[model samples]
Target: MINNSSHVNWRPTADIQSLRQRAVIIANIRQFFALRNVLEVETPCLSNATVSDLHMRAFCTQFNDPMSPQQKTLYLQTSPEYAMKRLLCAGSGAIYQIAKAFRNEEAGKYHNPEFTMLEWYRPDFDHVQLMNELDELVQQIVGCEPSNRMTYQQSFKEHLSLDPLSASLEELQKRGCALGYEHICRDEQDKDTILQLLFSHEIEPNIAKQRPCFIYDFPASQAALARINLQDQRVAERFELYYKGIELANGFHELANVSEQRQRFDADNAQRRAFDLPPVVTDEFFLAALESGLPNCAGVAVGIDRLIMLALNKTKIAQVIAFNYQNA
Candidate 1:
């Protein structure tokens, strides 16, 4: 981390020209949405409740009441998902937002504690239609062609000669060990985690290197907010976009079943307890909105900084952001 007193660290990581380019990109994004008649909206950055995803840790602060004696803890939103879904439930059709998001336990070449997120929702769109729209938006921003699409099973089969969906835990462990991950005790790890490890370390690097690629239909165990496929009950209607092995976006065909959504939230909290992490309070309001009937929709959150990094051919995420966590 750079010392706070350092003069050079006070300057923006990105050059002035790059900042200007970023502005142009943001303008283009607004234009793209405006042409499609998608209303741009804003939501709260801090909330009384936050995501219960086991993989994400939210930054929190105590909100001391000046007029009252009560103090409440508020969490910085990891994504604008829940609030946007609430809007969708209120009959806001096809909305988008560019907002600041925060996550704890993240800081590296490709990650920062705080970053910009471009999130949007389409009320009647399915995951495939959303994927096509995402492809168009990305291509417009980066001047790249439409991304190649593949299923998660196909990616694993083509890259590692393994079927991720059908592979047993023992098979996954054996393959992981053979691939130089002997340090991990396969027997103690879950199948989904093992699949993630292999996909990140081996298969991902071989995905479309010159253009973007969309990997869809993930295992049911890996689904966060995505609905499960009816034809194939073992997979979820989830997809992630990657460019040169770097994940840029994650989208889901929104799960509207209240009972299932609550169960997922409970499971996430249970996993958090197992991991020795503090359990986050479930967003009751968001669940209430879900109960009120959120329209069938698809939503996606894209890392704007990472997109800029790729567009400018920059190696580090800090090169695109005005100020990184260390300096901020």
Candidate 2:
């Protein structure tokens, strides 16, 4: 005897209207890219490796093979970045993908274990150019006002009155403490980590409230897959778009040097060790693609659900998606 009544609350989180609006927006996005000749593409949802970023967690599952006497663990891709870049190395011209990505993270109004991502790459385009195109796309879909561009240094200076580029570790920590964050964890006291904490807590809420904006040229330490600026080695050619102080996208001038990428991956593993987190293995296939000459390109990943949320004036991501994590 089992009970299967109304206790489950089995219904979609989003309404029918939202689903229709989402479809229209997605169609518009495809048309926007199609006009620019950017081909839509797809990649595997599972991967042999995972993100090395110290802040993110990846979900994993075991795969057993009948033809072989071994079981291999597969990670749900946190982003389709590495695989997409492999396609770029294979000379798949300008490409875009609306993908489902996964990350084991704290559930919140803005976060889910599984979410939709709109990612793309453009050859011969720098981060600046990508920002321009992204701004156009956002305006086209969400009808936001034209976005403005600001450098990361300018943002920190305007908001905190501190120079993030040359700020010492002690200075950053001191600022964090002054901002009432005295009990931060020991493992998270690194320069970039502290900077991110300050940015998210103090700065993000105040940026681009009236219109969208792009903040570019991030600290070299926080580059991730972005290439470092040649003229100013202290910063990397990375940018993020924000609307009403909410982050909408992140872009980077793709790092093409194999040796430098390997070094960055090792550095990430070292940081993971410092934080007592399991070190993630580097994706050799991605590195091999880089070695075989990835074309010079700029790339970005956007949150489609978030975009839908903004478009519908919905506060929670669940209001824009068919099923949220809990409901699903």
Candidate 3:
């Protein structure tokens, strides 16, 4: 015999009032983009490839076919970027997508495994133009002007008194220890970890308290796929928008070099190997498209659920999601 008297904690769903507000904001956003002639699109959630970024983890699935002794692998896309860029290469005009993206390791007050993302690309536009448009889009959605803009170098110098473009690994480690970092890496380090630590601790909390802020001109090593600014050879033309100290979006001046991109992808896989993680096969289709020709463009992605939560002053991401991970 089993005991049958267990009580279940039945938490309610997202607040209806907040949901309505989110709906309104989304509607307005659609109107803004539609008026600007941006074509809305949808891409598959599952794919054979995933982002090459070392930090982002993708969820994988396996399929077995009975007709033949064959197995297939699929990944829940971390971002819709690859597919959207393929469309760009195929001459799709200015396009945007409201997509549900997945990540495996992210779960916290401000993060969930699954969340909504608003991604867009503008052909023939540089990162500067996209930055301005980011400001306009946020203001139009929130009905308020954002704060101001600052470069990555300026931000680091102002907050940590460290030059991110030239700071040594030892200096970064020292700063991290001084700031109460318990898990500092002793091995040879790169700029990414140092920048992430500083951004999360010193700079992020102090940004956009009054309004939104755009932190642009990232170090060249952190460019990912963004193009380096010709005037500033040490920095890439990329920007991240922050609102109330929460990161809302990231944009890039697309790098259209196929060979360079392939090399970066290989490097990422090599890093994965060093970390004892399995390397994903490269997306040959996307690479072939790049080889053929991708339009000169700028692209960006905004966290929609975060935006909704911000609009309602909700602190926990679970409050906005229909079913939190534990519940799911």
Q: Which candidate, 2 or 3, has the higher lDDT? A: 2
lDDT tens readout by residue for model 2, 129-195 = 9988998899988888999888999999999998999998888888888888878723455788788
Best by TM-score: 2
lDDT tens digits, residue span 165-199, model 3: 88888888778777877476344376578679778
Residue pairs that clash (backbone atoms under 3 angstroms), model 3: none
As a TM-score, model 3 comes out at 0.94
Residue-wise lDDT of candidate 1 within 1-328, one digit each (tens)? 8666755557888898999999999999999999999999999999989988877888899999797698989999899999999999999999999999999976999999999999999989999999999999999888887899999999999999999999888899899989888788356468888898889989788886989999999999999999999999999999999998689999999999999999999999998899898888889999999999999999999999999888888999989988888877
lDDT of 3 at 247: 95
In model 1, residue pairs whose N, Cα or C atoms come closer than 3 Å (at least 3 residues apart or on different chains), thus clashing, are: none
Give the Å shift of residue 170 in candidate 1. Answer: 0.8
Worst 10-residue lDDT window, candidate 1: 1-10
For model 2, the stretches where C-alpha displacement exceeds 4 angstroms are: 185-188
The predicted structure with the larger lDDT, 1 or 3, is 1
CA shift at 51, candidate 3, in angstroms? Answer: 1.1
Q: State in Å the error of residue 296, model 3.
A: 0.9
**CA lDDT scores, all candidates in order:** 0.92, 0.92, 0.87
